[model samples]
Target: MMIIKMDDNQKLGENDHRRLGQELDLFVFSDLVGAGLPLFTPRGTVLRDELLRFSEELQAKYGYQKVFIPHITKDELYKRSGHWDKFGEELFLVKSQETKDQMVLKPMNCPHHIQIYASKPRSYRELPIRYMESTVQYRDEKKGELAGLVRVRAISIDDAHVFCTLDQIEQEFTTIMNMIKEMYRVFDMKFRARLSFRDDSDAYIGDAADWEAAQRTIEEVTKKLDLHYDIAEGDAAFYGPKIDIMVTDSLGREWQCATEQLDFVMPKRFGLAYVDSDGSEKTPVMIHKALLGSFERFLSVYLEHTEGRFPLWLAPEQVRIIALKDDANILKMAKDVVKKAKEMGLRAELDDDNETVAKKILAADQMRV
Candidate 1:
């Protein structure tokens, strides 16, 4: 076992994700790999994949389809999305070695997803076209913000977008809201909604009428669902209003996780449109929804929330057998149990070693396996 002594200032709890991640052999960060870049172990990768699959399957029930996008794109993509003007400093710029081509690691998936929608001339019949992708997004965050998974240079977002007409906006948004509620219910997270509306300031885009209509529609949903929420002006995105889901962690501290946003400006900027029944082109509204804003950040919060003692379904190892004796018969028995568990599709393991039973049990308890 690797042990490092800490000074007075460092106070990671017994089950802190950073501490547990190391002790549980989940992930590690090497100095050679640089800060904010984590290397996940086999077990850690399984945990991440399981969470992602769960999110995808849950969203699939709400008319969402999986869509894929590249990790890098040209700078013009962001410029057209208006992200260049706002977040250009945070992007990781890449220049071609053979040519003068310049590219950037995507800071957000909104622009790429828009391309999918605009690939073909859509019609009113396909009013709500929903697409989802669990992909990593890159941002060159400041050194001060670098930590375990809380703040990372590369993060996976369970992101989705729906292009719908003005009349279908409420229904599409409501579907996303229901999906968010179901996700939180599975995790047993206590949350409240924040209706983020524009202040009608010069910073916000789109017409005043569009912003007002969007805000009022979201308000109606919150009221219909009887959700507890507060209005926060000037909290909306530059192009739209949003409903931000705020979850309270085990320590009673609150953190924003999921968000469902309404955007009217980007579609217009991209010239994205659909044919109406009257045979005229009309701009479609884009809804940006992220159930888990950042998959890495969500794991960090969940690990701390459950203190590494996950329920059976989410636990890395559901059962661990420690042989009381080192005899051949006992070791074989333990191996057989593990084999049978595996055949039954269970995460089980046999602890066969020179260590004493008491020590093995202590180690298992520490891992919560």
Candidate 2:
């Protein structure tokens, strides 16, 4: 274990392991591999799997159809979605080795999700189609700005896209809002909502009438849910307005976790449409919702918020079974206990060797394991 002196003054009771990331060995960022990119050690991977399980349960309950898309997409895709023009600065673009075409590592998953929606001709019966995916996304962040998992080159966003009709937009949005609230409740987090809207003068795509209708619908949903939110002008996506949920951490810091965005632009740009009940084809309103903004940023926020003392359920080492002595019998018993814990679906570890029990316990405790 590596230990660094935190202060020149007294050492009494101070969490020596807040530096514990280095000492207890959860994750690491190396200069050689570049900044903001993290290597999740074995311990960290275990914690990540638990997060995935939680997301899976939510997906199943909410009727989200899971789909996977390529990491690298043609430049034309983002260009069509307006992301290429507006968000090009943060996107990582690459040219093909064999062909002259350019591609980009998707910063967000919505464009690809739009493609899926446009893949099939739909009727009003399939108005609300929710799709979910947990995948790695890449971004080109400034080197100086990158720190740990909070600001990183690559991130996994807990992304979902709900494509629905104009009438169904409000109901679907409300459901998403409630789900976001419930998700934060699971983490025992206190959050505030931000209503992000566009400026009238902005040259955003879509009609003024549609924009006004979308904004009004968002307001109605917020009022219906009795959710108190702050309005941030000019925070809206080029396509539509959004409701962003900001969670306060243990250190009294706020981080934006979930967001619900209404888009009428992308559908039209991608030529996405569905047959109405009257058999007339119309563009479907798309709601982009992410319960966990981005895994890298979430971990970064969570680490500091919890100060690395992850909840027992999310802790990488839920239990550590250490032998009292290095005797053969004790080692055998420890192995059995570890096996049983694994069978019970608990993340358990056995530390048996020449190391003293006190030292092992301290190590696990420092890891907040």
**True lDDT of residue 320, candidate 1:** 96
Clash counts per candidate, in order, are 0, 1
The alpha-carbon root-mean-square deviation between model 2 and the true structure, to one decimal in Å, is: 3.4
Looking at candidate 1, the ten consecutive residues that score lowest on lDDT are: 1-10
lDDT of 1 at 258: 94
The best candidate in terms of TM-score: 1
Q: What's each prediction's TM-score?
A: 0.94, 0.92
TM-score of 1: 0.94
Cα RMSD (Å) per model? 2.5, 3.4
- Candidate 2's displacement at residue 110, Å, is 1.2
Q: Flag regions of model 1 displaced more than 4 Å.
A: 1-10
